[model samples]
Target: MYQVLARKYRPRNFNELVGQNHVSRALTSALERGRLHHAYLFTGTRGVGKTTIARILAKCLNCETGVTSTPCEVCATCKAVNEGRFIDLIEIDAASRTKVEDTRELLDNVPYAPTQGRFKVYLIDEVHMLSTHSFNALLKTLEEPPEHVKFLFATTDPQKLPITVISRCLQFTLRPLVVDEITEHLSNILNKEEIKADQDAIWQIAESAQGSLRDALSLTDQAIAYGQGAIQHQDVKDMLGLIDRTIIYDLILAIHQNQKARVSELLMQFRQQALDVSLVLDQLISTLHELALLQYLPELSLKYSAEINNKIMQLSQLISAQDLQLYYQVACKGRADLQLAVTQEQGFEMCVLRLLAFRPLQPNEILVSQTQVANQPIQPAQQPIAQQVQSIPQVDEVQAISPEPETVSAAVDHLDDEYYDDDPFNEPSAVQAIEDEQSSDDFLEQELESTVEPVQVVQAMVEATPVQPESNADQIVFDPSSDDALFGMDEELAATSPEQEAEKYNSDDFLFDEIAPLAEPALSEQTKIPVQEVKQPEVTESVATPPQDSLFDLSSVPAVDAVETSTVSTMPQEMIDTALMPQDILKLQPQVLEGVWTVDKWEFWFRNSELSPAVQELAQQGVMTGQINAESIFNIPKRYEALLTQLQHALEQALKSEWPNTHFQVNYAEVETTTPYTMQNERKAKAFQRASDLLHNEAAVKDLMQNFDGEIQNIQLK
Candidate 1:
């Protein structure tokens, strides 16, 4: 005996229908103008007034007081139609009668007059379910029905209906209701029913309906029963298994503040309550959207409670706008990754950790501005290790540090300097040098006992012998110059002979038949080449020492069979070491070439130069434009400008090593002339073409083509 709320509150007339004003107005207008279509079709989703409108139209046609859109409920015909008992109103569920025979049978009564009303109404509900043959059988009758008969069709899916059947009918489509429309309708229904309900609870039910009035009323009926009398917000939330709004808001705030522990605690509560974690991420994303709206557009309303609005405003200010966008994207991505995670709880925890991990920088970790960096003083870059090792102190600086005490070696050197105009290496002078060394030694011993401290003697030794002898025996050079016979000879020893000198120092060491460095030798007739006093360049103490990458630069060293080492007592170890080195290494890095440089020479040099692959490619791509003021000018395409700039310094160094005087200058420009790369490619292509033509003209190839019908499949140059 209990009628459900959906059925009890169903709209009966055109005026009573909710959220279908278009259909109602059209039908009302047709009735007022007396221009009603005989075949009527209503189409929409479930619970959107499709069947309801069709039934209302049926009542308007059957009403007693001349047919009208608003039929009087007091009439027996209207009452019978409302109660589903009108004889003339034949309602057919097309889903049940889909056979052509059933359609033909249904069309059997179309010619007859109305038994109880002015028109015979055939209402087919879910008409799309009818078979093709059934639709074909009904199409003719539906198009031209008798004067007193009307065909009414209603289907949720109008696309399934035959276009022929649809063409004969006047179709009206119904639209689903929005949340606000459903909510307002429900409130009015509840008010008329005199059932108390919370607005939030009603809103929850309306939102749950998803724009269907039937579902909204059905939920309202269930809620009324569940609440025993009055619907409450908490009861609705519990019924729907929704998390508390305040809890959701608090969880979001905890994540924003980087409160990991608090977030974990709240997540544990969610786990204990068995709430949907995915739904929580959805809510978080939604809340972030609202927060962004509040941040960028502060004037926009959130349509929430005052407390919720205040919380949103505070959070918008607390988190940076950039961070808000990052958090939103991270939340959305986490939601998608949830299904792939091993467990839902682990996935949710990881997502929360990400939100806390990618927060804005703290005060101490802020980046320094360019202005601050510019204000700080710049420090020089550290020299390479090899360069640092080569930086030896000058001889003057060594003398300044500790004043040189003239000892045996300094006395011998002074003797050479004083006797430069005469025979410096004569036997007498050598003997005199030995006698002076002996006298200096005796004086040093007497002073060592009285005034010369051991520390001062050690300092004198260090200062006197500035250059240490190399440990390698092969590094010693034979210089037939100074008193080689004076040093390390006792008083009882005799002077050396020229034959002994020649035997002691190898004859091959005297390569040039000219005067050599240091004091010239005045020995036997065998030593005819007088040693020339070559004045070496004076190196100032202020000049910085250049770096030497290696101890032995074989590029500058000449090929030599051997050099015999002989004791040169008077020669300073530094001068001996310099003389021992090859002529090229002894000289500083040469700056100027001996002759003019040519492009062909440069090309040959480039072909042989050892360069990296990228650097080599750069050289091949560049075209030598001209030589300007001893500089080789090259132009590379502007497209390769960046590459050229990067490899310019290295390529220039390679070029300079071959042509020292010619500077390599490269510019980025449109290279119109042929480069090495283009020339090489052209040469290769021409060679390939010539080879191919020679192969094609061969007799063996012609025989194979004429006899065996063979064709050349491919040609490749190896």
Candidate 2:
């Protein structure tokens, strides 16, 4: 007869229990001191000595040694209890007969006297599965059980048990065994059985058990049988389908070294083997955590094999602690979101590549002591900021990078010089002028924020530079005092007529250096008044006359409605062929506001937004819920929440800036609903349809398409 290792090595006494010393000690002292409870409850995870402890306690109560903690194995009562034949001790599986009728029938004979032992014991395993009515029926007898009887209840999930039923019993929580504890116990068992087994194989079984000794022993039994009474690491790995630790070590090493090729190769191997990717991520996360632990506490002993510890040590030394922490977090998030991915392999590969993407920059992370010393600011020997900025080129690289010479746009270049170096406090006129321009730094920041290339600053400057009309035999001069047209003409085509100026600025190379910038026209018109004259260059008969060209002349751009063969003379031939959004500057007007809640109103609000990204996103996804005197309420999605305190303060300031004395608040909306984004999308769709119809129906477009074999891929409107 083959006795399985699990049953063969089942602990028989209190001291023999593997991991639950606290429960054992408490029960042992209670029995030794003649103190006993009517009922006892044992609870923990599966195979963690819960039911086994219950049976052992039953034997101790019925043993011929007169109810002692250490049962006499030789006695008939103890032997019968051990072998499941004890008349006074009853072991029940509550999971099967969980009905109230069964519970009532079982409790009907509770008052009966013990037939053989000094005290009768009732052991019920998996008691949590009992029905609600069954618990109510058993609760009375459990609370007021006969003095001669002992009740022993065991369950893996104590939370499922009724509080009324659990409170009546002496609860003892059994802890899951650590890996090292299970490993040592299995080694002792294997030694007694005289079975040859590798230490690593035994550790593998222990690790796989996940803190359950019975499961570990059961796995060891299966391993021994599979290995023909001999356990080896290779055989165990083959049976469990666990990825080899060496592969994990190599993978992590490759990742830390940023070996993309090796990482891809290893992932291919995993895919070919049909390995579990989620499990691999879990292991990677665990290994990263261990490496992080070893970084700070290098001398600390870990409960793993020497090979695994060596791998951890190597990784700790190889990867920085910050990088390890980052890898661990990414791995954890990947594992949690693994099910959301379209494929497990995609999720796993992304997790691995993400680690590479966020690898710590060693050069930037660690600062030299000399650099730190150099960064210390000098207080007493501090020089004027202007002198420091101009004379000391080596003082700051940032200072040297700025102050670049003028390029195409004199307006932007002059503004940068005034912004970066000039003292705005000393020059009140310049201060007012800068304040009126709304700070050129702000516009530069907005453009630069969305740009990646450093040369874009110069490119944007070139695009904004104004062009002067080419010098001819005649020159036009305007009076500075009067608000009239060019040369003091007071018609609608006067200097004050923006429409006439716009048309001339586009058609003719008129000087706009004295005029206001269109982006912020109000202040530019009021404060930036300048009278100018153009000096015509004398023509030479020997020299050839050159055609005039102006960079970024926005006024000359033709309208979309005017995209016909007739307007081709004034507009460029290329623009007609590649024309896109061409909204007329003459017809363009600021959107009318309803000053109340509606879809159109929301569109207006979103169009005129000045909110931070976090709150702006909230506003875009939310609908206006309510409004008080000065405060506006918005319903935001619960899943997408803002830091309410920070958002409240920001929105308060923004609202006051836009509409004085106004305040705002946002809260998590209860119901899911459509938002302002939906309206914006609807608007975009209609506009797109209009553009597509106009392009496909146009006569010039159809002729071009027929002649050039060209097709419109997309259409956009400004």
Candidate number with greatest TM-score = 2
Model 2 per-residue lDDT tens digits across residues 283-375 = 787788778888888888876678877877877887766567777888888888788889988988888888777655442222233444334
Residue pairs in steric clash, candidate 2?
484-495, 485-494, 485-495
| Per-residue lDDT value at 81 in model 1 | 85
How many residue pairs clash in each candidate at the backbone level?
Answer: 4, 3
* Lowest-sum lDDT 10-residue window in model 2: 542-551
lDDT of 1 by residue, 1-718 (tens): 9889899988889878999999899989999999989898898888888888888899999999878988998899999988889999999998998898998888887888888899999999999999999988887788788989988899989999988988999988899888778888989988998999988889888877877789888889889888997888788878777767678678778876667789889978988998878777777888888888888799985545577678778888776676678888998989899999998878887898888777654322322333343233322225333333233222212211222243333444544452444533222332221233232223323222222122233333333432423222222123322223112121112244545534433544332212222234432223444324422234232112222443222222211112323333245754443333232222222223224433343444555669888887877876664553356787778888888878888887776665566677767788676666765565456545544544554443543475457887666654
CA lDDT, candidate 1, residue 232: 85
Ten-residue segment with the worst summed lDDT in candidate 1?
485-494
Model 1 misplaced regions, further than 4 Å: 285-305, 312-328, 334-380, 383-718
**Using Cα atoms with residue i matched to residue i, what is each candidate's TM-score against the true structure?**
0.50, 0.54
